[model samples]
Target: MTPTPKRTIVALAIAATLALAGCAPAAGGNAGNDSGGGETPTAGGTLTYGRLASASDLDLHTQITANNAFAIDKIFETLVSFDEHGKIIDWLADSHEISADGLTYTFTLRDGLKYSDGSDVKAADVKFSLERNLAKAGPLTLTAPIANIATDDAARTVVITLDEPYTPFLSELTSFASGVMPTDFGGKTEEDYLKAPIGTGPFAVSAWDPAGDLNYVKNEHYWQDGKPLLDGLDYVFVADDNQLLQRLNAGQIDAIEQVPAANAESVDGGSATTLLNSDSWAIEQIFFNTQKPEFADKNVRRAIAQTLDLPGIAKATTFGTARAASALIPPAIEYSAADAHDEKPVLAHDVAAAKQELAKSGYPDGFTATMLIPSGNSARAQIAQIVQESLAEIGITVEIESIDLASFRERFKAFDYDFMINSGQSDAPDPNGLVTFQADPEGFSNSYWTHYTNPEVTKLMHEGRTTPDGPEREKIYLEIQQILAGDVPYIPVYYSPNLHGTTAKVHGLESLPNGSVRFQDAWLDAK
Candidate 1:
């Protein structure tokens, strides 16, 4: 069993995604007409979204993928949220304040707040939700700085005191995981809540017939007035890429995301569609089973990293929709490392140097290892074949194993696979998320894939998270990237653009730097 249940069974490593709060369209590509019909968003319509895969869980604290997170976001409202402008503002809160020292934060609930169950949303509920999530959630690390939570009913204000200053506290609170739950959330187990979730967002889970579809209805008690423009969302589960696209084309599904990297070209069949493409924070990598004694050496990981060709893989996999990822954060992150496009760094594509490193690692004759990948994905199969051919050049014989998604999940979480080309989206824009995934072996849920452990990485990630935004934080992450480059726990492959296909009728969908999509105001045009 995987140590962390929060990662979920449906968490796919192949998604071209980056995640945080809110979403913005990517800069490159055609950036097609995604702004639905110029008509004002109407109040009545059911937008049936064709998802790439089914959501295993809906509990925000446990939801791991962008699909689950985005769906859950519709049903759960956080104390804070980002506007379309990408600025964090009080969502459930009428107003909030932070002490000058940054150790104290206080917020007052918005007026006339009522959960779908008719229970009042109060300061106490915020405290309960925060306390519960901090104790048992994948996002615990982000909220670890909070020392205590206190609520004053008379003032209708909740105050949170942090053990230390956290500059990104507001940004972190805007996440789907920070969604406020009812005070009486009587779920003793995760399954308890998964069966029945209660939240105060724009929508509520109406019905979930596992094999058929999941439906969400309008939350009449939603605090926001006339928002979430649509009446409800009908998310249909479709696993096959071609079937999903066909459904969207035939109007069986209003919209669909995760357009397969390979099938992206097929969608442009002269249809009047809105193709939304965005720069993603996802980093595809060929991970090493560092838990194994044979891969315990950094030199060995570096050798494999140096042997592969990232640009060639990106070109073939994305069909010119992506750029080779030199850093973990993609071009969407226009802040610090966005400019640090380490184009073809040293030792990159150097077969001879990779062989030398392999020899130095006491494997002069190279080695033989099992490379596992999901069976149904042609893109992954192609990538696996390419990596195999490249490694063969250095005398490393890789035995490719194409397994189903279920078995692959088990093998990945168990650190049971020897070599695998896996991928994942970052949870946020700051280096904190990826750094956590890369550095700590047991702290973060995503760490299951990369069993990376280094005291320097741990320390640097801490500083990077806690440090105020400026040259210092940037310098810290830059140094951390250097460390990752040297250690090569996971080789950076390429950053692909996340795509969404829909008829010109669907509008008001946006993306964030982190690879997440929010349809808060998404509505379908009436033909």
Candidate 2:
């Protein structure tokens, strides 16, 4: 589960599906359409994936990291699946319905689904998997909404109750954390089950070497008809991004994600391999520790937010792939009715306005503080330098400090900092998770860093979560965005672009809005 924050805790790492102005595709852009007629499907080839980190285990309910999710997603079946745009749809389940009151959900399973071990899946297993997920360390914004779960084996039905109405509740089921396992295999702690996990998925865990390699073979009885074009998958763990890129270039691995921003330019322009680079559903931010006396007043935060040139930073940071992100809920998420998100500038660049606010903040002469960034991310380091210079223009001297990813996370969780250049991926595919998490005093959400206790933010987040109607939910979220634009808790810098490298011979590998790869209908062809 812990693969060193593959959650794309990017300096600007992310993937998502909101239609923003000038937004790139999650798959970068469609390449190899020369075969407009399409090519014949070929099976029996093995796809070796060069992963960003090693998987701790394949147990979904216990650990769901970005690294393992790529593995477990194929090995375990989720109740729902997300589309190219990150909207939730039925997968293992034939259909689902939420109550009008927005507190209960009913799902009917697809007929004849079976575990990789050939065991028939029952509704009881659905109840167990979800309840187990709720019992785990998965994000509370996604889990806390669920109050109860019940099963009816005969009807092949699963019923779920929520403590409150949550708009993204349905989408949350797409996670492998909600992956179903055989009821007979239920007794093992997620640790023991890692030894042998049985699920209704396209692939089965054939071998696991934790630090070396993890292999997955096609489930002979895979429910989908003629699906999973590849015979097997090999996830070779290569923690170093440079090595991963080199391996892909050398044809050592069939594909790789998280291509280093430094190497993206040459790779994207070269003919050696296919480059899929697109906008991701993540936002990198420079957060102000609101509790600190220097930033206790919101005006200082606003001053700093407006001083930075966000567009320039994004272009310079992610090799011109990631764009300037202006909102907490990035432009790639579904914030507008037009399949786009409005990144209303809460504090767009205006040095005069910034100086005015700084003066009002009782820091007209400016102040000195420290900005923490996780070591080893070039994107973050570059952006930090830019921010330091921007703040200096407004009279704030930010001493940039670099710490390891683990310690950075530790310090961030403790809310011990003056400011930080940090990022997070959306666990729940909807905006509710990040919007509310950032405002709510939940330490896990890192909202505590802002020390923001706005009742309006909390109320709108609740309304946006619970409201069942789309139009109504839209109004609530827009107001919430409007408020956040003015509040200046954190200044979003950019939306991390999803950059992927694969052999030009490979086709149909979907770059899901979450920046995940799915090779279900993929095929290999002659070079």
Candidate 3:
């Protein structure tokens, strides 16, 4: 089902700016209550948050989902973090210096640092955490250019030497994937640590159930004094958006993420709740499994791309909470081709052109296919329906299949679908964060599951990573986008804004540009 036409148009108009600015503040209502403005924060309540999905795992080094990152951000501390303005700032490290040649980095740890278990945090922990991530070759492997790590316990310093000058290295350090852990996981088994992980962040996990609620308690040893003003945090998993909103309206939960655009008005109008919307570097797209025989031909893929109207689909699904995406990189990130479509419209919708392209393929009369979408995501469900209708006009029969999140993820990772609607958000401010994950063939296991590769694109990705941030770097990414546009491995749909809902009593909750909600300083006013 689609949102009302009026709501969809209005949302589309407002979201156009979000597509350009990428990190604008909350547009429609109260941005969020901050600790400043002469209003002293009153702490002590345990804020209950309604999450749309359960975290697959809490292992910061291995897990790569946003659900896991949200929980891990609360339990772990990164060497650096992004401030309100999206600038990288020191967190665990008090100061850092980069060599003039850009191959070496030295960081000084904050003095008297202690973990949630009250163990002293040393440079060895940082070295161990990074080395572990490197060995595992997880998300950090693609962006981190580390060659060696040297730590000095006496000086409280860690020095890293890179094989090459990597521009996004510092920004990558801000990701939760780089979050620090004990040298030997606090002397607990991997199984034991996953149950209740300890970190130097604002909170520590007290209990976690894969199918139910996960609970946390304030970290007394957290270095940031008088921060994380809540007594604790309680995350309740609610799979459905409607149910999540109902819990928020019924005062059963304090806040929720991924609020549906159709329900944004209700939340904003309700006296008991508020809607928070902000620009995000998130993109929703339809990925074609090129391994499938039906989609093996580029002409067939481009035919499918031309058959659907991205703007209409985006409007119907997001209800103006997103802008129709023209490029893989959202406009907010550096080196994004914000005007690529204007220069050359590769994926523009044209049913006649689609028919012509199909006529040139093996299946001139079109073919039957199945589209996969994760259940409980209202927007994705709507997108599937819209795509089903659009494809029918060209003699293509599409059967929509909805599966649970876990099953959907497993299928996605296994390349087990003909095509699927999925979304991804940037982990850091640099364009390299999501671009490398989505486009680099060898970097992230065939572009994080698309399995589409181009020799030129691969070379450009490598050049883009080592090249300094300047006109030269921008040219490399622009060329990559142009190439991907013609290859049609994935069809860009829309750039989404981060939408969240909160009870009026909840304050100090802010949405980051990378689509994360900051609950570190959130609190509850007495209801």
Candidate 4:
């Protein structure tokens, strides 16, 4: 949840599907040749996964959680993909060219591609997949500037016309929104499709256990040969991360994501498997509700921000893979300037200063604030407890409230708490998402919590959206970061590490931004 001035909040009413277009996958060109051309006995086995929670929907357009993304990445290939080093690489589309003006991008579709339903997937399908989100006008939309999309009648090429220059366009396209889906193939309604979606990737959803499990089977006619090596895939929603770890150690599941940092050492010490770590494209921050008296004052917020031990939190909550963050954009973003001060957050332990600020405010006697957190998120709960103790030292009382994951998210959306811990993931480093916190209706509706507003900040946010690349735009974003730091509307926590644990027998698991997992090339070795 983020804080914003409620009065100035404007909602951009674009289609929900359109919001995900910025992160669509690169077009997967033709890959029709059968692998090894032989009557190989069907390879099938059940691979179980530990999902953090049950997803609200499975429709590619509506699902963005780590568990759903893991399944989707296997079923749908994007036009572009990120390498292990976070660099862009080709995936579905053969090659792409952007006009010198950066407003027009043309994609050459791959030939011989067919949907699981046996319909030819042409450039038009790609265009539809890219634009459908905008047509749906739902909650899952991307916050970039796109003018229009058109595909040639031959269905072999797609062209995108942007309202303005967008340098990070491809990066945003790597999301599920841009994934091509067959039109009205089954009797499934749009809502049903989202909850139990279909796709053209290496596997398809075989069975979904609404309360506890999901399963996927290999596509006999998958586009790529020798793909989806596992016989089948399973995702089990385990509310407890500790239980997930225990299951993994007991050989019930092959992998689990985001092991609690506190228990990571234990997992590492056990013979279960190796703990994988990578730089994540997400930031975990403690957001302040500026709309309320509890955190309305910047002085109080800054004192709180300056008081915590970021390094200590990183070690205690996220293990060694996370680092203290000072800016919205993680260091992995290539465009950040070397001299940017906002990017270099203040990391200090000054409890005395914190106390002085508390004294200056009317709360010299210290007041209690409510903390809303997801009930089963072990990592967040641990971090909140740490924060509770830290703030108590400065005469501030934090009342922790843990609720169900679904209810917790809804509350955050509604700005129903004084403070909370959450994460914002970035596909590529850009300030466009800032609109969600600062812009009107389409932005964080919960901005009402902060009661923070600045026409200048709003103007700069629009500028960043409209001007994808330019010296002026870069300067504005840097300034925006600085302003945010000074405002102290959000307390900088640590950027969590994207960690994945895999048994040695499982091969070809790749890490993506947002703590997502991709397994196009994965295969199971016989135990």
Candidate 5:
């Protein structure tokens, strides 16, 4: 089979600036086409998928977790979506247009679109879904700039006006959070709608249990013709990685998500299974609470950053599957300075330089600090251990704390820790998704929890968002990255890769750059 083409984030950024008029459908229709000795596509088998965890909830507007987004992508349809190459393209919207001022966006729904319940999709539903997202104020509320939404039901069109020009607006619309829903939730209460939501996507929820398996059935009224070749999806929850791999190799499960890096080689070598890998938009890093007394000084923060060996940590954790990150933004996102490693060189590991930097700080002799990590994640725990050993050489004593995922989230959001290991991913393909959230002080509290701020960074972030010229915007982001490297608000460890394992029977399973697995077009061969 011919390999699919890949586009850099720069192309995606430039594409966002141009007005999309009467655009064609997104790519990836031939993702796993029968070629290279594969069996012909068949359409009536139910695929059993193994997952490490269960989704917290199916409410697209409220939850943006990986598990939830993966499930929601199939059950809901967004106005726009990213093709395999990362370009924003039309989905539910047959065509769209943007005004010269970049403040107005217009969309026309495709004819004959219907929800799983066979209800017609109209402009009013699109208007209501976007407006409701603004009111919820969730993490996916990238729609906060919308000033008003107007609909013309007769014309099947919706017009949205923003307060100002937001370059990432179109890319943000691809998120599952912006998924279209029935007006007033089909006249059902919010609680009732969430219990059994309906969408115009290729699949509908047949049964769901938070702690057990979740099942889905093909939507008979799906807008896409002769698609969703699989009869249904059976998601089996398997928390243990070893057992998950065993099941896949044993032919008990057709596919598995989140394949551990250490087991990638073994899974690929297995006769019945194959491993899928792609560049991921996520990054693993250690965040410093700038407000805390121990890290309040810039010299102290810089000292700690220089002491840890980023490349060593990455290898120890991901086992060559990931590369040491050179910038806050992952390389997959647009305007990322990740390629500037040689020129910028973000705090390369140096024991002697670290000692000198520490001597210049208020705590000349070093100090003791605690680093927190989620309890169940072995990769993070390994990172903490590596940091503990490295910092010791510089006379800084480090303590590692393991906390439950729930408690860790509460403390993380509350800014209650001195230092912590965490991984973050962009909601969209644009740099505005991660850069603005991390550097823009006016928004999300300086890197979303660090309490670190720079006046210049704040100004540049504003300029980058409103600037329409690609070259000019690139200069602004490059400057911001240089500033961030000097400030050391967070120390980037590695860029994570998206990994999945599938049995020989599975086909058409593609992983998006944002680390999402698309199963809508997947099919299975007869045993």
Candidate 6:
């Protein structure tokens, strides 16, 4: 088993995706001609969603993927939440304050809050949840900067003490992993709790079909004044986008997640459908297992990074909307320095340099390596093909090994591949969120592959995490980005936008930058 600290680091590294809160559409009744043809519409309707893969687990802690996160976000409540505009606002907690040093955080609980089980939500539950994460409760455990947790029942307040000042701590608290679970429930294992999850969100699981769909109903007794506009939610596993589009056109489902870029325009062009565009907190990149023999050579890594055409890949994969990225940290973060940012350099078709680097690295003859990719993701497949063709020019052969979501995750976790196209959604708006991969030996869940252990980089990251924000902190962060750029542990790729397609009948769905959705203010208008 990985050490507790390393596991926590891995947990943080798995997702850097931001949330999109309260994202709204451009017009109303966008779903094909909203004609009230003498039919009375029901007040409550089921919102069916399409997902390529079924969730591995129902527990919010293990719900790391976008689809699972979307489903879990509806059922679980975070202490703090980002509004549609990406502003931090209270949700479970009425208010919160950070100490001057930024190591201590205090939160005041909201009154009348109760778990789905009808138990009062207290400060002790908050303390228990944070401690559970630090205790390595599951894959979502992220104890970065968190040293200890304490609560004062009499004062109705909770206090969190960190080992050091971390700027992104507050943002991270709003993550799905840190979502508080009920205290009274005792379970023997993770499997027991996941089968039937319970939380304080505005929705609760009414029924489930493990192989197909899960149903959730509104929490009428919710603490918030008004909530869960719809009567119930039905999550169906529709693997095909066309089928999803057809269903939505037929008024079967309210909204759908992950409308493929290939069909974004078509969906928008539909009379009743609208394409809702928002910034995805996710960043797509090609990661190399630095521990592997084929990737140990920095020359090889740099050569590959210098030869591929990122713009071409973005164009081919994301329908020309994505910007080719050069930096590891996405542009959303505040601490990222402009000079250190990767400028999406044009390697063009540099066969000569690629060959030369291969020669220098003692690989005079071509070598073969396996590339892992997610099954059914057309964009990943296209990029993999482009990379394969580009590498072939330099006497390198890549055998593509594509697998379903389950196999893909297990294989990647086992470090069984040489190269892979890994997507990241950063939780915090800092470069340190990226460092969790390199924090410890196999730092985060995603770090098992990077086996690139460097005392200097580690020391610098440690310093950057605790150091005060100033010229010194900026200089350290910029230096780290520069070093990682040159080292090429992962080849930075294009930043893709989060695209969604929904029926225009739905109103008040604000698109958030963090790529998270909220149904709080959503309402349907009968035409």
Best by TM-score: 5
Q: Candidate 6 versus the native: TM-score?
A: 0.86
What TM-score would every model get versus the actual structure? 0.87, 0.84, 0.91, 0.85, 0.92, 0.86
**3 versus 4: better TM-score goes to:** 3
Per residue, candidate 3 scores C-alpha lDDT tens digits across 378-478 of 88888899899988988889999999998998998898999999986777777666666776665543565777878898788667766777677778888
Give me the runs in candidate 6 sitting further than 4 Å from their true place.
Answer: 1-43, 145-148, 186-193, 240-252, 337-349, 438-442, 446-448, 510-514
Q: Over 4 Å off in model 4, which ranges?
A: 1-44, 67-70, 142-145, 153-155, 184-188, 335-348, 428-431, 434-452, 468-473
Provide backbone clash counts, one per model: 9, 11, 2, 47, 0, 30
The number of clashing residue pairs in model 2 is 11
Q: Which stretches of candidate 5 lie over 4 Å from their true place?
A: 1-17, 20-22, 28-36, 442-446
Pairs clashing within candidate 5? none
Task: Write out the backbone clash pairs for model 1.
Answer: 18-514, 18-515, 19-514, 19-515, 23-511, 23-512, 24-511, 24-512, 26-278
The lDDT-based order of candidates, best leading, equals: 5, 3, 2, 1, 6, 4
- Runs of candidate 2 exceeding 4 Å displacement: 1-37, 57-59, 62-65, 98-104, 140-148, 161-166, 184-189, 209-213, 261-265, 336-344, 362-364, 448-450
lDDT of each prediction vs. the true structure? 0.68, 0.69, 0.77, 0.63, 0.78, 0.65
Error of 3 at 116 (Å): 1.1
Model 1 scores a C-alpha lDDT of 0.68
Candidate 1 lDDT over residue span 380-488, tens digit each? 8888999989989988899999987667878887878897877756554444556666566656544546677778876776666566666777787777777777788
Model 3, total clashes? 2
Question: Candidate 1: where is the Cα deviation over 4 Å?
Answer: 1-37, 83-86, 137-142, 186-193, 210-212, 265-269, 334-338, 341-346, 446-448
Please provide the root mean square deviation of candidate 5 (C-alpha atoms, Å): 4.8
